[model samples]
Target: MAPQDRLTATFTRADRVAPTPLRSIPQLRVDGLSVSYGPHEVVTNVSFELGRGESLALIGESGSGKSTIARAVLRLLPSGGHATGRVAFDGQEVLGISERGFRPLRGRAIGFVPQDPANSLNPVRTIGAQAQEAAALLDEPDKAIRKQLILETFAQVGLDTPLRVYDSYPHQLSGGMLQRVLIGLAILPRPALLVADEPTSALDVTIQKRILDLLTRLQHDLKISLLLITHDLAIAAERADSLVVLKDGVIQEAGRTASVFSSPASAYAKKLRADVPALNPDRYAALRDTGFRSLKTGQAPKIEVSAVTKTFTVDGKALTAVDDLSFSVPAGTTHALVGESGSGKTTTVRLLLGLEGPDTGSISVAGEQITGRSPEALRTVWRHLQLVYQNPFTSLDPTWTIERLVREPLDRFKIGTRKERDERVREALANVGLGEHLLSRKPGALSGGQRQRVAIARSLVLKPDVIVLDEPTSALDVSVQAGIVEVLLSLQATLGLTYVFVSHDLALVRQLAHTVSVMHRGRIVEHGTVADIFDNPQQPYTRSLLASIPSGGNDVAHMRTRAFG
Candidate 1:
């Protein structure tokens, strides 16, 4: 449905009726909540009210205490954390209660959905064993009945193969499937309060939408009070009834989600609203305002894939990963390959980077063929081509100093002298907006954004002509993501860098790419300039991806695209 149609459907008479009788006392009330971890106070004077069956979002960047506040409410704070406040839940004081006293209400009444399902679920145990343990909260004495109920809940949460999921361990499933399992476990007992902490941050766009929609449906159908914790302002605007914007343990803005989106009072809130790619997709407009008009005609593209096909043999079965894929990226411009997971985005990138050889087609970089190249020959191509991974936390070596990490590429290539390499290291850091002060610092000593900047600097140290960004900003906070976007644009504008941005985020693609190829099931469904792709996508799959973008009722980007795109 169109945005207007969704609004109409939402405001229909049948949908206007309230689902549950709200309690006289608010479902939860936190009065002057201050959480201290040892000597430092992380969350201070936080206050919010969640009415029965209503959804509230605590939103902010990292270290903003959004999760801290949620943890305080649920009494799940880590060691040495203390809270000073009045927390009233169901007309009873829950502040500073004993672990024994809070046990009854923890999962039975107030369920929790933690972020990072990989870290949350037990690694060694099967899903059924872990789920059965969680189902104990239902107080169902019969084991077989509990097993049946778990399967039913699993299917309810949209796990297509509930039995298969039950029998499998965590590693056997994908990230999205594991997340659905976690949601199923959280909702098994039908708790009144559901606290989901960044549950869909790691998933791709379609899966994220499905998980969020499932949560909304579960909230309404069960009449459960919800507390959504996230950094994405657009998601909060679309999902929550009310929102509380936090910064450094302080409430920057608090009000209805629509009011907050329409009229954000605080500067931080306004910046966040503008940083959301869905709400403000023209983030890098000024840098790329001229578009691809300057690219001279008759010049070959920087990267080209001509009818590339890559198939891997798994369990004696040939799996075609990239199917007749072809796209050309002009020099000094970005060409995004947008698709969901397992849609051949990574496989195509691997083919381009010479990480994997194509089965039956040719790939080229800078007019040189990539397929059928030896490892020794591919090194020459790799020197002019580099890759930026999705997660910086793992891509960068934690033990290596930042300077060493960036300088390693130069060292491996043996491009410069001792003094020259030092100067080049500083130059790369300066290019990515880093300073010499962070040279000696380790990855653990830096923030997520800083780590990513370091990763970019390392990639740039080799002076590659082409860089393949693998969902570069998907893991960072919204503001941090905007900063990264700015850095990337600045680099592209200043250095005439060519980029193959691989991602599923269409909104970010609007801000980043000059041309795009929409891939689905290992095939490009639509291919065009960014303007044609975003303004008038022809394929149904492309349209569906565009529709899934959370507009937050802001059309500034679309309006700008008509003028410049």
Candidate 2:
């Protein structure tokens, strides 16, 4: 089914019915909700109401008080965080209830789907055991009844082979699948209110859409009120009925999603909307022509992979990650290898970087082949290649100053002496738009976007000819991501470097890549220019990916792709 069909399918869940009836009165009400963590107050003077099946999204960047408000509503705040709010659910004053009294109301009246499914699920337990345990808490269960419900819930979220999934452990599934299992357990009890915190952040665009559609459908059918907490404006616009914009623990804006998105009342709301990245047809056209034109001639491949393959043995099970796949990267351009998690994009990068040895393959940089080479043989080649990882914080040492971090690369590669290294570090910081003062600061002292800049500066300090960027900007804000992409393009032009950019963000991919390769199950399903890939994709999977991208236009033809096929 297309997204248009799915949207129509969503209508079948309900007939635009009134919000769910409040069984007792006021489904949930928070009055003067002020929650303090130790002596520091996180949520202050917050008040909201969820009438029956209504959905109210809490939108903000990281460090906002959205999560705190959810925790206070469930009385699950961390130690020293005392909530001074009058919380009423089912006509009972929940704030006055004791711990014992609150226990029954938890899963029965309110269900919580946390941000990280890894943190929520028991790693040692099978999906069936966990789901059954969760269900048992709500009712005296027969094994058949519990298993049937579990299978039904799994299928409802579009997971294939529900029985196989139930029998498998959490580690056996992908991140998206694990999240769906967690969602199933949360809603199995049929709680009146569901609190979802960054539910789809970890999943791919396609899986994210499926999960969103499932949650929305469940909310409608079950008449369950929803408190959606996330930083994505597109997601808020699509799923939420009402929106509450928060900044620095303060309410920036609050209103219906349609009205707020159409014309935000506050400056913060306007800025957030402005920050979102949209497609640029002209730039995309330019990138498309460049890739095909460059490819037709006998120009040097930016990167060349011939007969590349990979395999790994996990827990005694042999897994083939990549299977004899090959591709090329043109000089002075971006060649993106895109796929979902476990689709071998990262494996390909690892093989190219010599982090892992391939069973059989050859990798060519510019024109020089360097595969299955000894450590000593590739050491010299690594000088011209650098890698930018997903998380900048983990990549950068907390104890090392930015100057030391950047200069260490130069020192290791023996490009410069102490004085020259110092000079190079200063210049590199400036190149990445960081100042001299920031060079002395540690990673913890900087923000997420700044930390990523430092990581880029470190990679650039060596003046590499090719940079392998692995989801470098995926974890950043849309506005910050735009800045990072601008910096990368500017640096690529100035340094005349090629990039093997690996990512799953289709919108960002359209904005960045000169050539695009869509990977599925460790195989390249579609290979073409960005325009060819997005505007006229040949492969069904590529079409699905293009369709998954959020399009607010009311064109039924445009939104025809369903969440998952």
Candidate 3:
């Protein structure tokens, strides 16, 4: 049978089996759970419970064992990983079950949505093929009926064109679309519990809100218990009924979301709350006031773009990626370009970096014309500008040690003697808050935040006047993001560095940017001071973006005022 037909048959069988109803017992009870790899324990004596139809959030920084606990509950751990704990669902023990015994409950009673859709999806298969295989797990004999159910589920999850989406490959879909596909597949079996692991972490804010809303609606409508794993404190506070904060593999705090946010008992929990950009807007605002030096009245801007436009051709069609874009960054202040995916933010950055020439207009870096410059000339200009990319893991060469990665820029630029180069690397690392002990380590040895610090160190070693940061802290935990932001602010203050910050996160943009430019559909729709844009947005698009930020009605503005007043 074809993939679509096979998928249909699978859902048809799932429909025949009625979903397990909520019982008197807790929906899920995890007691004294411990997960270890060899002799190294990661999750130690973790315990939590969820009542029927309730939602719980597992939150912490990277390697805090949030994902480990989730995987352990699902029996999804890899080889050499051992999980010992009492995990019960609806009064039945889930641990110590044979593979054959666990097979029936894997998808039928429990559903899982992984962190990265790209990682979880089969790159070689079409969307329909994967959906079909997942549905077939239901063991439905009727192919036609299963297909109908799958299509219906797709529509229910907001995929209006089920046929088109089903036929498309994973890469053909947007991150949001791919996320919905995963949700559709997860809910096809009508499982009693749904475990969403960082489901929206990789998406833009607007898409993240939509996905969260979708999950909320599904949980309510289906009466499904949800276990959400995330590093975002705001999301946990807004989405879950209860919150569990973990650090170093141990539970720091767990309680009702409102109660925890209002009066967090643990220092770690309090730190997590304070680190959230949305929760503590004044923290960054204060840094801007106290630390930042004012620009000279008549000084030339560090970077300027005038009437820039860029276009690309796809399948014989010309598509404008950036249109008449113009913005300027002062000598030592941050200018943020905020937009959703496909809003031309990346194209604008490429234009600024001279990675691509504009079809029209001009770009100037450190008051030097760069647009249409020869490679040799631009190479000279590149010494004054550098880019810190979104993902440090991918950007840093894994084969090279930290010392080599930091020194590569100095070596490439041929600046100073060997001793001087080594000193520069050490100075850069210190500026980013990394110690010399990490110098001998590779990218694989560092944490997510540490890897990013190394990336910043490499950029700083060049002593560039302007650093274009592309979503630098988007992948980090709330606390880690706060630390990175502090480092950036400190470096900017002490070194007089200019930054062109590009991000989809409006909250972070509001915190760091002196000037803000809102981009939509390859055009700058709004531009103003951060205060004017955030406090009193003029454009409809800008207002819409601000309104889309997920707030669990926590009165964040009031919280900020009270805390920072």
Clashes of each: 0, 7, 4
Model 2: worst 10 consecutive residues (lDDT sum): 556-565
Write one digit per residue (lDDT tens) for candidate 1, span 301-370. 9888889888899999999888999888888888999988889999988888888888887888998899
Global fold similarity of model 1 (TM-score): 0.93
Q: Residue-wise lDDT of candidate 3 within 1-565, one digit each (tens)?
A: 7644554454453432335663457878999999999999999999999877778999998899999999999999999999998998767788888878877888878899998999989988999889888778666767666676678789989997998988899999999999999999999887888999999998999899889878987887677889999988888887888999999899999998889878999999889888888777778765675323554353468888999999999999999999998987788889899999999999998889888999999999988999979888888888989999999999999999999999998898899999999999999999999999999999998999999999999999999999999999988887888899999988887888889999999888878878889999999999988888999998888988998776556553334224323
Clashing pairs in 1: none
Judging by lDDT, tell me the better candidate of 1 and 2.
1
Q: TM-scores across all candidates?
A: 0.93, 0.87, 0.93
So what's the TM-score on candidate 3? 0.93
Model 2 lDDT tens row, 248-290: 7888888877798788989988877766655333443443444
Of candidate 3, the 10-residue stretch with the lowest lDDT total is: 556-565
Off by over 4 Å in 1: 1-22, 295-299, 554-565
Deviation from native of the Cα of residue 534 in model 2, angstroms: 1.1
Predicted candidate 3, C-alpha RMSD:
4.7
